[model samples]
Target chain A: MSVLLDPFAYSFMVRGFWVATLIGVTCGLLSCFVILKGWSLLGDALSHAVVPGVVVSHLMAWPLVVGAFISGMLAAVGIGGLRKLSGLKGDTSIGIMFTAFFAVGMLLISAFPSMLSLTTILFGNLLGIAPHDALQLLVISLFCIGVIALRWKDLLLFTFDEQQTIGQGLSVRGLQLLMLALIALVAVAALQAVGAILVMAMLITPGATAFLLTRRFPAMLLYAALLGGGLAFGGVYLSYFLDVSAGGVVVLLQFIVFFPILLCSPRGMGWLCSARGGVR
Target chain B: MRTPSLRGLALTANNGSIAVDIQHLSVGYSNGVIALDDVSAQLPSGAICAVLGANGGGKSTLCKALMGIQRPHRGSVRLFGGAVNRMLKRNTIAYVPQSDDIDWDFPVSVQDVVMMGRQGQMNWLRIPSRDDKRRVAQSLERVGMQAVARRQIGELSGGQKKRVFIARALAQHARLMLLDEPFTGVDMTTENDLLDILREERNAGTTIMVVTHNLSSVPDYSDQVMMLNRRVIACGPTAHTFTATHLGNTFGGVVNELLKVTGAVAGEGNVAMSRSQLPEYPQ
Candidate 1:
């Protein structure tokens, strides 16, 4: 029992656990929209695109979250613009924009070697998070979750049927930009919890798992949030005992939960037997 | 710009009778291809207008223009004497798009989809009211799809999917309804049932514009016909305008072959043939 409670005794561990869970819940909520809109590559692009912004912030002493958000949003807008202007496919646009931003980050880091640590940016230092950083993550997570809750129906309609949304006098462009902005904001908030490298997994896995588990969107959302929060708590708690990386373990735990659900959920491979048996 | 006198004449010409009024509308793609060119039409309220054309004959583009999805490079669209966007915001317009435009794999229930029609009437947060729920149920029942209201949209068959979309339009209580290819994949029975529903709506004073390449059913159902080939080849009452010359001009070479295959005479006043005798237009 003491061994189980040991991690909670440490202040940093408690802070880390709360921050990870908040990020997990927020990402999980946003992930439903991301998955339904087929924007997994956009999530990945936004996450990596924040790297140069972090480096620039460290050099100029700006707020890291602000720089990261602006950077991610810029990448998103650039991808949109490139797709529109060049008639390039969506994946190609995303690939070109994110790689360019990430490479610039790599170049900046090498040129100013002592400024920022690559390892810390790629794999987050959750245990070493400052109080100010935790507060930033909290505020961002709450804001994102609030926006999603308030406009969920409109967002869902826009994703499901863009033409109807437009015909109903809703701003399809506004909803699209709102989705990209939310993704950027979530990517920024998650940057502190899971870092740039694994943020995409945190955004996609929970929603995808929920998708396999349920047919209704609202149920999918509820399941995703619960699964995300539970996985984060479990990862943080187990990582303290295992002495493994908390962020790494959190992402791994998502996959660990994902595969079993994929194999057993009604929408997945399990449907084969259930469908066949019912037919018989 | 038109002079004020001409504008007044245009306004009084349509008065409150027109459901859709487009004047010299032209829409072009970014790649310099014109989708609609100098298209003009004024359809009256409480009528079924069949927009007939070949593939790429600007049928979908006209629908989008009416729905304010595609911006016209020139001219204007007015619905019921108001701007298109303004009428849309009043919840007076509903659109049933082609099934191919929707993500069938989306995790939305049929009832939830129908409820989307009430979004404009809901509060800012879009929570459905009791009245909204009642309307959704009524709309689903109208389409004979109330039994599957709880089912996911992806679980529905093609005909059921089309009915669900039609139910969504009905739930909107829209004064003007636009449907793109509402009968592409439907069976003959379902198609007839859908046409009956449209007739009912028309009787209820709803203006319906149906965009379809299927030509056989137009003369029977449509009160007005707008034959388009990037421009309006003919636009008037169905009895006067749905002639073989207009169809041949709208579909280009395809109508000649279709006339031969169907063994229907291409002369004036003999173009109205039964669906069984006419082959489906080559798309």
Candidate 2:
């Protein structure tokens, strides 16, 4: 308890709290869109796709988030374009693109082994976050949420049916590109707070859990945001006490929370399984 | 700049002005597989136009072109005598794709699905207004989906799910409604009710185009019919062009072979009933 309080007393802890809060709220929102569209793999792909950018940035001592955003957007374009052109399924394309991107990133790391260590890459350090990085996170978080808030219905319609939306005269291609851009922004914003591996958990788990528990779109988003924020905050405190990896603890807690909902929710996997069994 | 105006002409019982005017429209996949070629048609407003064809015909592709989902390699499509610009597409045209295209496990409710239609009308940041909610309810009632408005869309039966999508399209109050196989998985009553709602929309001056395989009902119900097989094989009144000659010509030889194969498998009859195989086209 005393050690946990020690981190909060410093300015870094306050900034860390804000970063987690924003990541939770923002990631939660995007996660709902991803999960609903059956694009959870996209969340994973976007996170891993940022590896090249992160690796190169760290290698050159350049800004990490900038590299991550560029790489993530490129991954989105590559994956989406290939799927459209080849008519292969979304997951297969995402898998192909991310594995290749991640492998290239890893090769880059191997080539410049001394530039970055594992801890900074896999799980971010709160102490190492400059005040400037924290501020950037805040601005990016606000901007991403604003865009989401603005295009809520358009995004929902486009996710549901690109054809229907296009018929209505909306620019289906434009909305898709905008959504991918936002998704890229989200992946980059989360890099410093939760790192590449755990960011997906933040983006997907909360939304999936909320989807299980609710039917209304607005309520689902609200539940996801709260779930995300709580897990992120709780994970930090848990790590403080356990002296373990903060991001790992956070995502584990998310799954831990998500399990009960999956089982107990009226529309959850558990209920679905039970109904399917009875029918059989 | 791309539209033609031919209103107020005593135009052979055409009923209303052209809702969908396409001239020399051609569509093909990137692989160069042609879907439509030099297809020209005018779907009059206030008419139930049934697009009829065998599998892999251009029925759905024609719908896509008219709805702006895909652009024609040649020619142009005009809706309501105006060139279709990006901004007006949302309000002027409403589309319903096949039900099977959706993931049944997606976590959205019937009302949420219906409300998506309003996204075209509302600003991105603003919440749906009172009028939007009322329109949603009205549309649900139109499709008899009001009872399951709160239910998850995935939980609905195939027929009920189609009704929900119909309700969504209705909520948009679109000038032209294009439905691709709305009758596919639905029961007879649901199909009747759907046709009734479309008729009501047509009565209220909305042009309705439907792509369907349920050939028995097309002649009796549709005001006009367009028979397609990668091209405009024929287009006219349901009663006239729906003859066996046109159908055999429209479907080509491959379909006749399929009918013979199915006849042997099902043991329905020996002659294979050319009339049954033809599947009476819409007018």
Candidate 3:
């Protein structure tokens, strides 16, 4: 208790709390869309794409968020364009392009030997968050959440039955593009709190875990947010106490919770076990 | 003539007037092999219409064209008085695709699936209010799935699943229901129920079109039957459309045998059928 109090007393630790909480909440909420669309790979791709931007920003002493956002969105557009023009399927094209971008990001990092906190980008250095990163995350999370709240039903329909939505005159492509843009923003926001390697876990794991337990879209979103928040809070605390990396631990924590549900979940167990089980 | 019931378009079905008007219509893959070649036709509204043909007859392509799901290389589709651009005015239009096209294992409740129809009726950026919910409930009742509304869509039987989709179309207040193949995998009772629903909707002023290979139901369910073997062989009243001559033209020598194949019309999964089964028509 005393040690926890001591950390809170420090301004930097306070900022870390604000920043991690924002990442956890936002990643939790936004991940529902990712999970539903089975676009979990997208989170990994977008996060990797931002690395080159992060490196360039670090070299120029510019803000990392700007680089991350621009690079992430670019990767999304590039992936879409390549899929369309190349006549390859979406997953294959996105996978090939984003992985190459990630490789480029890695090459950039290796070239910059004096780069600050490379491991921090992976495991996240919540202890060293500046007041600005924390504030920026807060503002961005609010913006994403606000937009999600306003169009929850439409987004849900688009993710689940996009063809049907298009048939009914909804702009399925427009909504999907908008979602990809939002995903880019989310990837950037979560980058510092969970690092590139584990950022996708944050974006997909919680929503997937929650999806096993709920049927309605609203319930899934809410529960995904809570589950994500819980994983972040739990992982952070457990890692601090156990003296390990929080991001990796959080990813593990998510799977730990999901595995049990996967065994017993009405929809999940059947899917995982290859039995025709009822959906929740 | 179909009744204009429940705030939807019935295509003014009586006069054999063209419900779908298209000219110089052509559709093809991105690789650029044309499926439809400037086909022109006017399907009068209200009666049940079928688009029948051999494997490469472009029957399905024609259906895709009418719904605006596919682009016509050089033609237009007028749903009512307006061109395809006015397709939005037919907000009540409903589509029932083949059975296997849907992933039954998908996690969706019966009611949640049906409520998707209400999205079009509700204003932009608004949730379904009491009226919408009432209509949804009424639709479930009509489809006899009210008790199973909370059940996941995957849990239903094949026939039940089709019924649920039809109920969803009903929830849309659709006056123009385009069913790709509603009878596949369904029991006779389910088939009859669907036919009756179509009749009820028609009497209440709904226009319907079905693309199918099942020949038996045509006489009982459809008022108009259009045969195609990559081209419109014959189209007119049900009696005229059902002659052995038209059946032989559309199915070749296997018309009777094809009927026993079960689950072949608009086959997306176990029930899918395509032009691959037919003899080569030399390009």
Model 2 chain B scores worst on lDDT over the 10 consecutive residues at B1-10
Q: What would the per-residue lDDT of candidate 2 be over residues A1-280, giving only the tens digit for each residue?
A: 5764775876766677768878888999889898887777888888888888988877667777778788888898999889889988878999999989888877887788897655666676644678887887888889988988878778877787777777656788898888777777888777677777777888899998998877678888889999988888888767776878777788899999998888777666464557544321
Segments of candidate 2 deviating more than 4 angstroms: A1-11, A55-63, A84-89, A107-115, A269-280, B1-16, B83-90, B252-283
Best candidate per DockQ, number?
1
Error of 1 at B48 (Å): 0.5
The stretch of ten residues in a row with the least summed lDDT in candidate 1 chain B is B3-12
Higher-scoring candidate on DockQ, 1 or 2 = 1
| Deviation in Å, model 3, residue A206 alpha carbon | 1.0
Ranking by DockQ: 1, 2, 3
TM-score of each: 0.93, 0.86, 0.85
- Candidate 1 ranges with C-alpha deviation above 4 Å: A272-280, B1-16, B267-277
Report the poorest 10 consecutive residues by lDDT, candidate 3 chain B: B2-11
lDDT against the true structure, per candidate, is 0.86, 0.76, 0.73
> Distance (Å) between predicted and true CA of B72, model 1?
1.7
lDDT of 2 at A261: 82
TM-score-better candidate, 1 vs 2: 1
Error (Å) of candidate 1 at residue B236 is: 1.1
